[model samples]
Target chain A: MIGMTLILKKINQLIVGLIFLYGIYIITHGHLTPGGCFAVGAVIAGAFFLLVLAYGSDILKLRKREEGSSVAESTGIFIFLVLAFTALIIVTRIFFTNYLPKGITGELISSGVIPLYNIAVGIEVAAALFNTFLALYL
Target chain B: MELLLSIILGLMILGAIYALFARDLMSALISCGIVGYGLVICFLLLQAPDLAIVQIVVETITLLIMIAVVLDSSREELKEKKAAEVKLSHFRKWYVMNVILIIVCLVVLLYFFKEVTSTLDPLGKHLTRMSTAYIEYAAEKTGSANLVTGVLFDFRGYDTLGEATILFTAVIGVLTILRVKGKK
Candidate 1:
């Protein structure tokens, strides 16, 4: 399908970068902010959606990138599982234990493995949702 | 705030009714979106910023997915089916029965809700034992400033893991169903 008009395309091009940046900020700061992995992941997917709407699916170079996103989705969940199991293997030997140091609260790097989990979830969700979008369009 | 909430909820219900009755599938989807955003607003009013943020994004994604599905289908065929083959009186009977059943269900639900909430502590003062512990100790235990995130990813990590697995399964199912095979 063809995309929108030139003015719409210009607007989408200008705003998509900002959207991605905001989504990244939300995902990274999930431990300290109201937003979390699922929310920010949807936001990032939304950026992709806008791009697809404004420039058509061809703009994504889907043939090359589809497999990449699928891999990323699997890798994200794998990383998340690894992180969870590492805690189980290490300190407490219990599943989903927080074995890492709980640094000072409110710091960027304070939340030990929580931030990492958030990042993993964010990647998984963003990739999965984008892949779903691509599948529907293709 | 209560008045505003009531107004928003009333509008949401109106939108839902509109969606139910809308002949055009696209307009019905739009009405569904309106109701979704109205719920987002309700979440914000309830002081759940996290829920509000998540709801809005989820709503957007859902709307996009629905739009894609609708676009992929033949709209002309859907439009042509608008002319009902069944008589109006036949539908009126079913519609009245449905309305009566809904009213009965609503009354039963309202009674059960009243009974359940009456047994619990008053609204503003109520906090279950586990939640109180979480609020008091989640910061010290998890070192996450956001208690919701701490509870979701750390304290209740297994639940989150299960959720992730569910999403993964859904994606796999979608990919499997939609995979395009090359002819040999």
Candidate 2:
């Protein structure tokens, strides 16, 4: 563990989880909210950075994430393609069509496939960027 | 609103110029961040919360990366200079010339700034012609209240797909570039 300071560690313990939760909230509520995939992805990546910066990059909990980041990235893209192709192959003959049931206008589950896309993109961008950070960091 | 945005814009430009001239790479990088964060404020002022969120996050991430780079590269201890007087004189000459050139550039930019402003539509008076269709049908057709996501994920999903692929490729590229040579 390459910790910088005890103050940073204390601050990070208090703040990083909230930032991560906020990122998840942004991703899930993307259809109803302003933020979506890319924004939330960066937010989550920032959370990872904050944690690593405080607790050191060698945190065993996060090491698994960095290790599987490439796989996670591919999985995200794969899910996106599967969602699109499902729209194409199954019911709607068009690509990327919102085939799922559209719930209420302002509800969380309202936007048919938009939230799904948000989740996929959030995963994709978060993993890719976090991977880069772990790599470039000394 | 326009006045506030303009002030922020001026600050951004000044910060950019300061970043160019600042001797300490750390402060220079932080001033560079001023430009990015200022744009986030501009986005919010323009009623684009989506863009503002995106901009701020990406800006912070990039800034953190830059901070890491600078922190790793710069030494904590200062090294004594062997030829301080001669180096200072030579450095001052080059710095003065660069400052003069930057001032000339700033003058040209300021001179043209009015013309550019004159051509632009006032803030918040943006022409809604291109966005009107999305504004109308995005909610109904896509069933998403946030029209930005509607258009991005449903309407023009191919673009999003391509964007994701591009990010994947970039990650691969970075990993490749950073790979340790002769390490299995």
Pull out the clashing pairs in model 2: none
lDDT of 2 by residue, A43-131 (tens): 98899888877777678354342377778888998999999999889978988888889988889888788888889999999988888
Please compute DockQ, using alpha carbons, for every candidate against the native two-chain complex.
0.81, 0.76
Residue-by-residue lDDT tens digits, candidate 1, A59-128: 7677653477899899999999999888788768888887778899998988789999999999999999
Q: TM-score of A-chain in each prediction?
A: 0.92, 0.90
TM-scores, all models, native as reference: 0.89, 0.83
Given candidate 2, what's the lDDT at residue A107? Answer: 92
| Alpha carbon lDDT at B127, candidate 2 | 79
Top candidate when judged by TM-score against the true structure: 1
lDDT for each residue of candidate 1 in B7-55, tens digit (9 for 90 to 100): 9999999999998888778888999998999999999888899999989
